[model samples]
Target: MKPIEITDIDVSYGAKKILEAITFHADAGEILGIVGPNGSGKTTLLKAMTRIVARDNGEIRLDDRDLDSLGHRELARRVAVVPQDISIGFDYSVRDVVMMGRHPYIGRFASETARDVEICDHAMHLANVAALAGASVHDISGGERQRVLIARALAQEPTILLLDEATSNLDVSHQVEILNIIRDLAGEITVVSVFHDLNLAAYYCDRLLLLKDRKVYAAGAPGAVLTRENIREIFGMEMLVKPHPLTGKPYVLPVYMHQSSAGANRRVHVVCGGGTGSDILHLLHAAGFTVTCGVLNVLDTDYGTAMHLGLPCVAEPPFHGITPESLSGLRKCLESADAVIVTAMPIGKGNLDNLRVLLDYPAKPVLFYARDHSTRMEDCTGGEAGAVLANLEARGALRVEGAEELLARLSRDGSDRD
Candidate 1:
C-alpha cells in the first residue's frame, strides 16, 4: 500500500504561496528523499503533508484514508514529522521529550503508564541517545538533540516518518549512523526525508524528489534525478556526475569556471598535482592556448580530473614508478608546448626526474609560481635538479604569481602572433 499520498497539493504561508501543486507518493517499505536549495519549500512540503501547514488545494491520504478526517490523536498515530529547525525552549529531560510522543495514546489528564516508559526507553535506545535520557534536552549537541527528536517521533509509533534535513548538524560518522538507522527501518516503515547533501541523498535514498523554487523539478532514482543537467539547472553551477566506484551511486564534482586560449599559437605544458591544474588547462583553452601534461599517475586526482576535462595527458600507471618509457612519452607530449608551468606537488623519488626532463628542452620557456626556492628545490630530486632551475632563471625563466598575470602574458603573446 502507498503509505502517504499527496495529490495536487498547494500550500501558502499567509499571502504568499510556496508549493505549486506538488504531487508525489511514498510507498510502504521504501526510502525516498526530498532535496533542493534553501527556501525551496522542502520543509514546507513536509509540514503540509503532516497537516502542520494548511493546504489550500488538493488532497492527502495516509494508507488510503483521508488525512483531513483524522483527529489529532489519529493523525499522530499515523504520521510523525521531524522538523528541520529543532530548538528546545524548555529544560525538559531527554526522556520527557520522547515521552511526549505518546500523547495521542494517553488518557486526558492521566499520568504515563508503565508501557509508555518502556516504549520511550526503547525509542531512546533506537536513536542511540539512551545515555542522555536523564540529561536536559537543551544541553545536548545538535546531532544529539536531533537524535532525541527522532526518538520522540519513533516513539509516536507512526507508520510514516517525515524528516526535514534530519542529519544537517551531524558529523560525518553520525550522519552515517542516522542514515543507516533510517535505511534499516525502511522495510517496516515508510520514510521520506529531506536532505541537502547530494552525495548523502544519492547514497541512502531509493528514490529522489528534487524541488526547485517550491515546485517539483524532477523525481526518479538517483541515477536519473541527480544528472549533470538537473544539478546545473537547479543549483546554478556546472558539475560532473560520475558513478561511485564502490556503491555505483552518482557523485558530483563541481566544475569551476576556466579561461580559454586567445591568440597563442603556442601550447603550455603544466606539471600539476591534486587536480589543481585542471582550471589552468581551461584558462589556457579559453585564451586559445593549447595545453599538455605528463608523468602523472592514472589514479592521481589531478590526472583523473584532467582526463574527465579532456586534457591531453600522458599518465603512468599509479605507483608503478615512472619508467624510461613514461618519461619519454611525457617529453613527447610537451614537445610542441611553448611554455611549462610546474604546479606545487611534492617531489619524490618515484617520479623525481619528471621535472628534470625540462632541462633537456631549455629552448622552451618555463614558469613556476613564485614560491620558496628551498622547498621547490627539495622536490627537484633533493636539489640535484634545482641548479638547472637556478641557471634557467638566471638566464630567463619567468615566474608568474597569479592567473590574471599568466593570462595577460598569454594575451600579449597572442597579440604579437596576430
Candidate 2:
C-alpha cells in the first residue's frame, strides 16, 4: 500500500488562500520531496498532513486509512515530524526530549517501561546523538539539537517520517550528516520532506512534487520536474539545470542576471579561446550588449559557452586552422563591432592567426582583457605570438583588466562603428 495519498486539498489562512487543488502520493519505502519557493505552502502542506492545520477540502490517507479516522495518539504513533528547529524554553535533558516520542504508546496509568527506554537508546544511537544523551538540549549546538529532534522522531518508530527542511539551520557539514542519516532510513521508513535545496532533492528524492503559488505545478522524477523551462516559469528567473558531475543528478545553478541594459545597441566582438571567455560572454549578453565571439574550434570550451549562451559565433572544426569561411565571418563581426575585447588564453600555432587578424583593426577600439593582473596571455606560438601582441599594443590596443572594467568601458562608449 502507498504510504501517503492526498487528493484535491485546499488550505487558507482566514481570507488569504495558501494551497489549492494539491494532489500527490508517496509510495511505500521511497523518499518523496516537496519543493517550492517561500509562501508556496510547503510547510503548510506538511502541517495539513499531520492535522496541525485544517484542509478546506480533500481526502488524506495513510496506508489506505482515512486521515480523519485515525485518533491523535494513533496518528502520532504512525507518523513523525522533524521540524526546522524548535525553541527550547525549558532546559530539558536530551534523553528527556527523545523519550516524549514514546508517549503515544505508553499507557496513561502505567510507569515507564524497559522497552521504551531501549527504543529511546536505539533512536539516539541511530541519530548520532547517543553520545549526548545527558546534555541539556539548550546547552548543545543547533545542529546537535536538530539531531536530537531526529532521534525523537525515530523513537516513535513511525511508518512515515516528515522533515521540514530539518537541517536548514545547521552548517554544511552537519546538514550533510543529517541528510545522510535520513537517506539511509528511506527504505525502512517512507520519508516525505520539504526541501529548499533543489540539488539535494535531485540527488536524494525518488520523486518530487513541485508547488507554485499555492497550487501543484509539476510532479514526477527530478529530471522531468526540475527542467530549465519549469524552473524558469515557476521561479521567474533563468537557471542552468545541468547534471551534477559526480552524482549525475540534475544540478540547478542561477543564471546571474544583470538588471541594467547598460550596453544596449552597442556591439562588441570577443576574440577568445579555451574557457577564458565564458564569464564575460555571459556578462555582456546579460547586460543587453550585442555580443559576438570566436574563430574558435568547435571543440573549444569557449565555443561551448557561446553555444550555451546562444551568442553569435564563428567556428571551425577542432584541430584545424581557421578556414577561409570562418575568417571572413570574423572579419564581418569585427567590421560591425564598436569595440573588441581579447581574453588571456593560450596562443597556440592553430590560433596564432587570431592575433594576426587583430592587427588589421588598428582604427577600431580594442582592449586586452584578463580576469586579474596575475593572468597573462600564454604565448605558445614562440616569440611570434609575442611579436603580434607587441605590435597590437603599440598601435592602440588598450590593456583593460577585469570584467567590470571591460563592461564599464563598453557601457561608456555610445558611438557606433567608425
Candidate 3:
C-alpha cells in the first residue's frame, strides 16, 4: 500500500472555510486515526482525500501521484472509502453488492471472471460476512451491513482504505470486532479512519491526528495527543486520560455534570488517598459544591481525577510519607470548608496523618464512608489509624454506608443550609 500525503489542504463551503492549512501523512501499512468533536471536519477531511469533497487548495498525493490527476476508475482502484452512511434503495444480495467493488478491474461491459469472484469471496470471508452473502443487504442488521460495506471496500483492492466513522453506530462488541479487523489489515494496507470513540482510537491506531477549529490541533502517538488539556481545548469537556489496565494504552473517561445548578454555597473538603477519592470528588463537583481534596500522592489515581476536574488539591510526592507542609495545607482547606468527607481506603503510615488531621478539625461536619470498617482497617498502621478513625467518630463524625447515602446526606444538608 502507498502512503497518503496531504499538504496545506484547504476546504471551504462557499466563503466559509471548513479546513485550513491542514497537513498530515498516513504512513504505508499503518492505521492513522482522525478524531475531533462534531463540525471539526473529520468527515470532510476524509471526503477530501477520496475527492468526494473537492479541495479548493493544496494537494493530496498517493505515493507520488497527485489525486486530481487520477481518473475516477483509477482513483477507485487505489483508494476505497467506506462512507459514514450507506443506503440501498433497491434490494441487492450482499454478494452482489460486494461484487460492485470489482468495477474498476472489470470493464464496463465485461463479465466477472473467476479471479474476480475469488477476490470477492476472500474479502467477504475477511470481513466475516461470508455467511450473510445470500441475504439482502437491507434485511441484515446495521452491524452486518457495515461489515458488508467493508467487504466491498476490501474487494476494491485499494492500497488505501478510508473509514469515515464506520463504527459510530455499532454496539460495543461490534465496534471491537470491526476495529480489530481494521487493525489487522493495517499490517498490509494503509488505513485512515475517523473515530468518535477516543479509547478505541488510542488502542488501535498507530498514530492519531486531532482536528480542532479548522486545523490540526495535535498529532502524534496516543500518549502525546490525548492529554487532558487537549480534550478540554478541542471538545470543551472534562475528561480523565489514564492508562488502560490491560493494554496500557490511553483510556478516556468523560466527566459529566450530573447536576444542573449549584445546590448550595457551602464548601466541602475531602480527605482521601489511593483511588478512593475519585468518585467522591466527582459527585461533590457535580453537585455544585466548591470542593478541595488532599493530601494525595502526585501520581495517585485520585490526584489525576482531581486535576482533571480543576479542583484544588494538596499533593505530596509519590511513595513518600505525608510531610508537615502537606498536613498544614490540608488543615487550611479544612478551615475553609463547611464539611469534610473521607472515602473508604486502606490507611497506611504514609497517609495515617489524614485521619489525625481530621480528628483535630472536630468542629467541621465530618463524614466517613465506613461501609466496611474491616476492609478500611486492613492496611492500618498497627491499628493506629483505625483507632484514630474511631476517635473521630466518637467526636461527632457521621458514618455513611455507601455513596448513595452520602450524596443524600449532602443534598439534605445543602437544602438545610439554603
- Stretch of 10 with least lDDT, candidate 3: 370-379
TM-score of 1: 0.75
**lDDT by residue (tens digit), candidate 2, 313-408:** 999998998888888899999999988889999998898887789888888888899999999999987799999999999998888899888887
lDDT winner, 2 or 3: 2
**Model 1 per-residue lDDT tens digits across residues 1-418:** 5888889998999989899989999878888999998988998988887788999999998988998899989999888877754778889999999999999999898989999999999989988999999999878888788888889999999899988888887798888988888888888889999998999999999999999998999999999999988998999987889999899999977776644436357777888765656666666665666777877888888787677667788778877788888788888876877678776566676666677787788777677753334423335467655665676677567776667777676566546655
Q: Against the unseen true structure, what C-alpha lDDT does each candidate score?
A: 0.81, 0.91, 0.88
Clashes of 3: 0
RMSD of each: 5.2, 2.0, 3.2
User: Model 3: which residue pairs collide?
Assistant: none
The pairs that clash in candidate 2 are none
TM-score of each: 0.75, 0.94, 0.87
| Cα-based lDDT at residue 196, candidate 3 | 92
Error of 3 at 408 (Å): 6.0
Evaluated against the true structure, the overall lDDT of model 2 is 0.91
